[model samples]
Target: MPQIDPNFVFPVLIGDIGGTNARFAILVDSYAEPKEFPVLLTQDFDTIEDAIQSVVLDHTSILPRSAVIAVAGPVEGDEIPLTNCKWVVRPREMMERFNLSDITVLNDFEAQALAVVSLDDKHLENIGGEAAHPNGKRVVLGPGTGLGVAGLIRSRQTWVPVPGEGGHVDFGPRSQRDCQIFPFIEKIDGRISAEQLLCGRGLQHIYQAVCLADGITPCLNSPAEITDAALDKSNPQAVETLELFVIYLGRFAGDLALFFMAQGGVYLSGGIPQRIIPALRNGSFRAAFEDKAPHQHILKSIPVHVIVHPLAAIAGLSAYARTPARFDIHTDGRRWR
Candidate 1:
């Protein structure tokens, strides 16, 4: 059994589920900060429900009446699947199991996209683009365990977050080098999605591919280790890996901008962008991003921003916890007139 907040009828149990980790928090009051802020290792808990239960036990005695979970999966037919983890969250089943009054499950990237609406300049680090348009449609993307992408539409006065699986979209190569690398990756993966070349694992893959391109011996390393070596300039291959990684990232971001028509601009969030800000600042990211054939002019106008805030998703979840259940406005701002 869980303890109940006698004063408040129902507290909000919020979660941000990702491929590698899941962050859980309990919002007891409407305006109070989360009482239980527990970040769980995804592999430790077999199920999301189990993880939720444990967090409730550790942080609060209250059994929440309503729960809002941001899952790293597509929300379809009341059920959602975790992108990298082995868990499926069925809102009705989970709510019934926990005796919740209401439940909402959203795409994790959607949550992250919505999260950026409230982020401030202090939370962002300008990588290689201009400032974001205040009242324009903004693009938010993050490459963690998996690449997550979403768009925010600004309506009359609010923001509506649009969910997408853009990461799984086909990879478009711009140059002869890219054309060569594209087939190489496709051969190994059978199909190379954006995730194949835009994430942490993707960084390693690019390093290996570059090695193959230059006919150098491949080196095995963790993402962090590779970044460190690349930054130090001690390893030429690592430096090349980072360079190619930025190129792919920029080109991919440019593609996203074109797809979303992100007039407000594009923002690169998650852990990767922050780690290589210097490289992104000095690298050929801008050239790659603006490499569209006919729409280069349009892309040049779209500013690309990078979010440095680590707690962006959590804060967005908090905002979602308080958002009206049936509002006319979508999370990004677009509303039904």
Candidate 2:
């Protein structure tokens, strides 16, 4: 997508930087609602600096002084490591190098969680669960280059965002297969985080683990290829691998709902869930989700939604940037460039 500058009073550059690709959009402030549209793919550039330069240079005749970037990695004070990609975005340096008046950096999951606050029914796909009540709290998790997790709580009139590195939490397995699968992952990664078995690379790892367990030669294809074969029912091992993945996703979602006591429901975002929606819809997921002891009833009532909107993070960023008070408080009173 090419950039557009239609002579608006001011335009804020918003970016969602992930391990796979960096998404850039410019939101113009003029009407009650800001105008936002995609500009380019992140892979086209070698670095975040180059990506930003391309966005600004291609869009407007002048450079904007302020910007906000949602990163797909943990934000440790001033530094962040994009889990799936090579660039590290330093906040202070981003400000200085970009010559911007201000910049806000947030965890990618936080941005996704925040975006849920403003999402309507149109942005979601109900995967056999009830809708989240307007007053209910929502949970969002996804497996991309890495698994991401976040919680949204209703704080008075608005939803307050809570970001977490839950993906790094220990992998919990149930039943015999999961029990068998755990040690296999642990042997390879030394420490088996959920992301190791639940993401894109996780998909590949699962495929290999299944093959290794079955005493068959490991598949030589990539994750994408495996998924394609499984969807077509051309590969039994691939289908079985995906089934285990979906079951784990259900169990994890149930666990997260319990942790949050989320009456609102759980949302599965990220790329993988959307691609494998059919596998997710199978009864195995709901069965695993509700397999909780005694408290299984609580888990059953909490609906699960898959975020289908590609620009959901951007919408959340727009909501964040639109709120002047949130911007001021979080930015430590820094002025917008």
- The residue-level lDDT of candidate 2 at 292 comes to 87
- Per residue, candidate 1 scores C-alpha lDDT tens digits across 129-209 of 555678788888888898999888876576778888888887766678776666556443466788888899988888777
Clashes of 2: 1
TM-score of each: 0.88, 0.88
lDDT of the candidates, in the order given: 0.77, 0.75
Question: CA lDDT of 108 in candidate 1?
Answer: 83
Off by over 4 Å in 2: 1-10, 30-44, 186-189, 324-337
Displacement of the residue 158 alpha carbon in candidate 2, Å: 2.5
Could you tell me the TM-score of candidate 1?
A: 0.88
Candidate with maximal lDDT? 1
RMSD versus native structure for model 2: 5.4
